[model samples]
Target: MLRFNKWSLTPFHLLTLLLTLTLTLWLLNVCFNLPTWLLLVPIALIQFLSFLFFHTIKEKGNIAVVYYCGYALVIFLLFKWFNSMAITSLTYTQWLGSFMMVPQPVFAYFLSSTLMLSSMFIALIYYFVIIHFRPMVLILISALPATICIRMGRPTVSSYLFIFMGILLLLYMYYCSYEAEELPYTVLPCTKSYWSTMSLLLLCIFLTCSLLLIPGSNLSNPIHTLLRTQVTNHLQPNYTTSTLPKESTATSAPTALSDTPIFEVRATKPVYFRTRGWDYYEKNAWHVKREALSLGYQLPKSEMNQKLEQKSLVLLNVIERLEKNGLLQDMPELTHLLEAPISPITYYAAYVTTLNYSHYMYLNPPGLISISNPFSPLDLYLNALEICFANDKTRPYPNEGYVISYMDTFPASNSREMLLIESLDPSTYNQLINFLLDRVWEQHNLQQAQEDEYFLKKCSDEMETATLHFLDIPNSITKRTYDLAQKITASSTSTYEKALAIQNYFYNGEFTYDLNSPVTPLDKDAIEYFLFESKRGTCVQFASAMTMLCRAAGIPTRYMEGYVCEEYDASKGCYIIKQKHAHAFPEVYLPGYGWRIFEPTIPATENEKSPLSLILLLITCLMFLFILYFLSKVLSEQLWRLWIVRQEPKIALEAIYSRLLKRLKKNGYVIEVSMTPINISHILLEQGIDLTWLTEHYCKVHYGHCSCDKTVVLQALQLYKFLYHVHP
Candidate 1:
């Protein structure tokens, strides 16, 4: 048997253990949403026993085997419990599907058990294979939980604290490893050198601050992007799939409206928040082929129309304010506001939850605006003012809100007259154009410079171009769609009238507005299915049908997806937008104006919640509060202990004394509950150790009722330092 000397646990060892345990508990609290006390107390007890077991055992090989087997057992038990609960089934496919549908409690239970088992596995590795753990390995181990928290979107103050502590632990571990190698235990140390440790810590702090100052520092790193993508992909399957509308695509299974609030906006009036647009239509999907237009602060002459210059300036001022207030530091778009042109109309919005999609939310014709945080590089397409984040990077939509100014254009006031003129005979059209030009010249009191002929030609060409753009549709469009379009518009005499006829066909209770309707099959046409087969669908289906009908009727139309804020809350002083508000509508491009908003879906009542849903919600809230209370209790206890260690000299003296005994036990020295400081000191002295001064002072303060002063506590600490350098 190899005789191992009992090692004294220094203040460093005690502090490190406490910090690591606290950090572990905090992470578990955040990630699992469990009661901290439920996890902390048992974990602390087990860690204490494990440390003692490893320290007292003379055979290192036995220690390795025992620790590994213990962790393996724990992992086995976790799986057994999970299986017994029926949270996961036997087949892989069934297991995955069931896991995705697991309720919060079961999910939390599963995650907590997994994390705990992971920690134990890491510990096993550290003790068995990697007996001489490197600082980098330790840092990586410490970062695992924090990484999980970030990936799960549960970042908390504790998560950051864990990172900071991990960095400090890296420095401490490096110092320990270096000191052990350089200074032999037999030699008395001259002095402790803290300069290197302090210098390294300061350098790390400086670098962290510098990184924050740089734009996209957190997101620009290749390591961060890779890690985030891997974690997101791994975990996304376990979460609920998003129901938000995507670019015109084959419809998926219908989903219920989530009562979860997404964002809130304070606007002068209700407006549609558009995120994406589709220009080209396939059999069942809409696609966009145009590349994004990159614009900076200076607007091009063509895009500068509609008083966008003034709007851009207003957005710039808001961005400046947000930047000054530290709210826009991460908002890359706001930082480069001068590079993009925006409309003059503006509103303020704040996010209540993270927007899962990469697209930026704006009104139908989004213009220049300021966001509260930075994002990854964005591509802004001109058609429908569509914005999409670059796919090469992973830019999640920021949870912060922004004050945005946008421009909105309504249909031309004379659109009706333009439609009538285009339908008139050629000689009648010429006469009408001449009459309009003469009236315009007379009203402006302008000189006749062949102005009537020029005006007549310009108006005719503009209307003709607009008509062709809006009416362009694929020849593959079904015969059924063409027939329906003609039948709906047959009674109408003008373009605007034809568009209205199609819109009214869907809106006038002709089709059922069903959010829970089955999806249209991929092989079938979505418009045909919605219009003829199902005759029941949500806004996306309704909008798709109307857009196809209008396009077939020679009216220019595009599919648009956005949020509609129909219900305003006066008490809140803002419009509350929820997942249920996600809407899709058709926009018809009029000849002389722009795309006009036309609603084809009839308004539907809110979905009534069943008693089971209400019960589940109540239970969730109760569980949240219950866990929160225990977490607060655990934190308060730890804080109190820290306060006593720092502020109370008598208590600090006692704690140091207790740590000495723990050190003796760790070093293979037997300690009894009845052993006094004097008895322990005698045993140490017999083994060529001296802690006489510390023993005497501790005894006086604890038993003799002698007051512990600052000098006395300092003397005890000084005496205890010799153990750090002594060898058995």
Candidate 2:
């Protein structure tokens, strides 16, 4: 019964095309590290299918609004689901994706979807403005680019893509408008159909562009190297011959660095070396438990080594040649890392000569050095066991039990002489004397042990009250900055601490959590959401939070509102802070310490630091949003009519009364667009306006059946003036 067109593709054919296009783009994107250009193919085909489906159905009046809203909601939700799992950058993909590129496809899908949605959203806004204003299409087209250039210079990829797509649709709309003019579809011709068509086309273009241009960046290309390297490493082990197994059951031979070395201590008595203590083990990683403070238990003076000792903290600059390696020369547990780069391979170059991924160079080889102790005599601890760094050049043959080992007894002193650690919360401080005690307990357990401490009613308990305080500021002005602070310091105590915490958070957070900051869809909570709601805030937001929170916490926080010191201050400057941007810092109190500086406005990224104009930038954003909102509402139908009617009514009674009704919108009075003349008169009078003359004229004409007159209208105008000016 159905007649098929030769050129038309069936639903099944379109569906197959959509799937194939999606898979092909994804595969190509992964293989060649492209921008996933093919990702748009499926989206375009789907859009066409959607159009076809909708074309078959008829929409009238407000029903179309529901249809569009439903479409947007579905797309946004789907995009979010995919975005949550998508890989955003190349470096990340290589480092983590080599094992699984599952997220990359997710990333591709969302990137495409987000971009498309953004374009559509902007197009919708543009269409609405045009429909509401009915501006000359040519002027609007010109204004789009002009405003873009004036407001935001040097458009970003997302913006460029959006504008480009929007403009193309705009041109199509213009073409349609011209066509509609040439061939009017209705007897009483109006440009509504043409404008409507244009709006729809623009929206479509925006959606398509957003889908094509969002996500992935050229900057992320280098990350492919890491991925490729990781893949290669998996297929081929990079360990030296000594680290490899020779036979299944033979005794492994040890290399030069395999044997443990002993070092003497200069202390008058023996002391224990503080090696890293392990508490919890899961997924081959160590997690240290927080130690509970004991008010009752105190460190004995005897335990404190009073003897003065000095040792230069040797710095080993390292350039990691392998992913498993770190920036430090050796894997020392106690050493604190300063300026730890988010990407070790990239930042390592600043400290040492770079080595290729394939090369192996040890700046500081494994060795033990003699350390002076406050306790034991140098001779007594001459052969004490300690942690030493090694390249693991051992186990040339088959090895069994474990790869590493520790000493069984005190090297040169009685093992019992080791001090026993005391704590009220022994369970919490799993280390303390527990490491040694646990071993003893295990042995005892094998031979039948004593009662459990808690079970035997030997444990004591204590508690502390939690206190909360916030630094409230006047007006809603501080909400954005303060909200950001709240998020950054959600885990912090004290305003001073929170300020420092927020500042530290920004300094440690992220700059580009995603490589690019793309414009999102309408549902996206605008820039303010980025600044306040999701407080992985920009530099200014971070800095503002730091300052404000510190101040609130009773710490001295200040907004460093100025340009970055591109050069140092002219004279007497000590540190020569070469700031290239605006920044804010909080001067926090630390009991005995007067004030310490904390920066909160740094980009939240592993390597990015807070810029010097975050304050200025924040203020600018605030102003921009305010202006934008104001402009968007300024030319609305209600606003425009109010503007026109506010002009003095110089007409007769009926006309003056009509104008008065329109102008009432200024005071939040809604004279329904279809208000009867009598109703308009009643509303004006009820609203406390002096409309006696107009009401009298209305009653005479509407109810008393008297004809309308110019004299009464003139009187109504005078009354309107009196009411609007004298008592408004």
Candidate 3:
């Protein structure tokens, strides 16, 4: 539940908050290795703005959460569209493809995303930590970034120390807030509540220490060890290491994917985990060439290390020179960051295989940048077109699969990039890639250029070969197939447009997607049969047909087999990949850019969303609760009245008199907690209010222990009216 309350910002509150935020962020900067002043200044702005917004709004209860969500959305859009650092003429998708589709995210891009994230987090901390003082929630927020950095291996182990201390201080503040009654619980400070609070405080301390310390990582504490092993293993998705043995073929009998979950994946977004890419089509089958199968080249780690070491020195010199010229204040890693390519369009995904298949290996999605396993260095095989593990080689795979950082955006998926790619001369993108390569060669490490020049050269060589390799169509391709491809793309100008045209051809309502299509006659070519005769097929058939057409249309195409995970488990915050999610698609090479996927599978219709359902549900829940609360209050009052009336006459008289004094006390007449009715009468009389009749009856009922009747109660009521000068 969220509440927006206008807080009285005392000096204590303001000072402590400033100190806490500065310390926490500075500590976090230590963990993240981000520039300090840049992060600090922006977050302070966000905090001030957020504080003003919340302070202005006086709404309370869960309705405030809706406001916060809307506010968060506005912040997201503001940064997404208006961020000048990374903005270019490219559309969002195009930008993602061209600029971010690199090995690592560039400086400004990383900072922009981080700043957006921090803005929202500051709003959260202001609400939960400052306004509410929820220690559990605050601790969770602190642990989250630290956990991510640890999982990604971005921050050093020593960085956890800063995070630990920062979180501990914040938690202590929350504890103090509660003790001072600023965030007192519904229950008062009784023995039970005292013990509970103490227990909770101890738990918070332990958790803060344990998470930052990474207790599972070679620790002596048995409790921490148990929590690490028991809790994590239970929550982790159990995916078997054995991959589903589904073979891709142009000609095969109809088949359906199995429901058995062969692997489980945990990723923020849905993606295609491609096994491999097929180059040529012949004899009614797609085939991988020898070059495609072989690992083309590997970069020596020493070369990367050497380049980094050189870049560091060069960057330092540049910063120093700029500082001497009064051009800049410091490097703070800014020089190297600016020289880096645009933000790499990638996010991290971690998945673990359930059954230990002796070797642990994750089926990383296409467009993978790097991967990591828990125990061993990743045993990987790569080529220009695609990547996979070296299955036959002697290498250790993590027993629990691995984590991958990947980006898999298709340039043709967006209109602007598609048009741009289409309009570009075939050699434009290639030349751009070459220019970047030579630019690297000309700068920094010019003396030992060959040492750091493997990947770009390999990509260039592969590009030279892809033309002859990917266009080799089957001899079985009929004249009608070529004619259809030509006819579809007759109006389309470029290779990207032609690929889209081919893809659109299958998505038209005339074609049906059938997983269990009848077997192709052995004599008929499968592509021809599917186009003219069957006119129905699974993803394999549709993708195969599209590939064949694109190839005939003089576009380089490859058959790609992969599993597309769509089923998202909101509970676990990851996607679940099953055997039934297997899919096949064609990768059409966009000259200079690289291979881009075109979907020819059955078109998934758009399902538009409306906020009406959620609004209605929320309204209903609140209304029901309001009515329930009203009824409960009335019922409790009636029960209390009934109980008092059912007492003995003497007791009833006293109770009746007690109500008059309670009313008198509300109007500035002083009364003691354990005052006699006579004492209250005297106290009220001094305030020019008399309750003598109540004093007499209450004395006779209690002190005399006499048999009092309804008349005494009646007298007390009359006196109560007279005390207020009302007619009875």
RMSD of 2: 26.9
lDDT of each: 0.51, 0.32, 0.54
Q: Please say which candidate is ahead in lDDT: 1 or 3.
A: 3
Worst 10 residues of 2 by lDDT: 306-315
Model 2, backbone clash pairs (residues 3+ apart or across chains), number: 29
The true-versus-predicted C-alpha distance at residue 728 of model 1, in Å, is 35
- Compare the candidates by TM-score and give the number of the best one: 1
Candidate 3 Cα RMSD after full superposition onto the native fold (Å): 20.9
Candidate 1 root-mean-square deviation in Å:
22.4
lDDT of 2: 0.32
How many steric clashes between backbone atoms does each model show? Answer: 20, 29, 7
For candidate 2, the per-residue lDDT at 545 reads 43
Per-residue CA lDDT of candidate 2, range 573-614, in tens? Answer: 211111122222233432211123344444335543222123
Candidate 2 residue spans exceeding 4 A from truth: 1-36, 59-157, 160-612, 615-619, 626-635, 638-728
lDDT of 2 at 479: 54
**Model 3 Cα displacement at 401 (Å)?**
2.2
Alpha-carbon error at 583 in model 1, in Å? 2.8
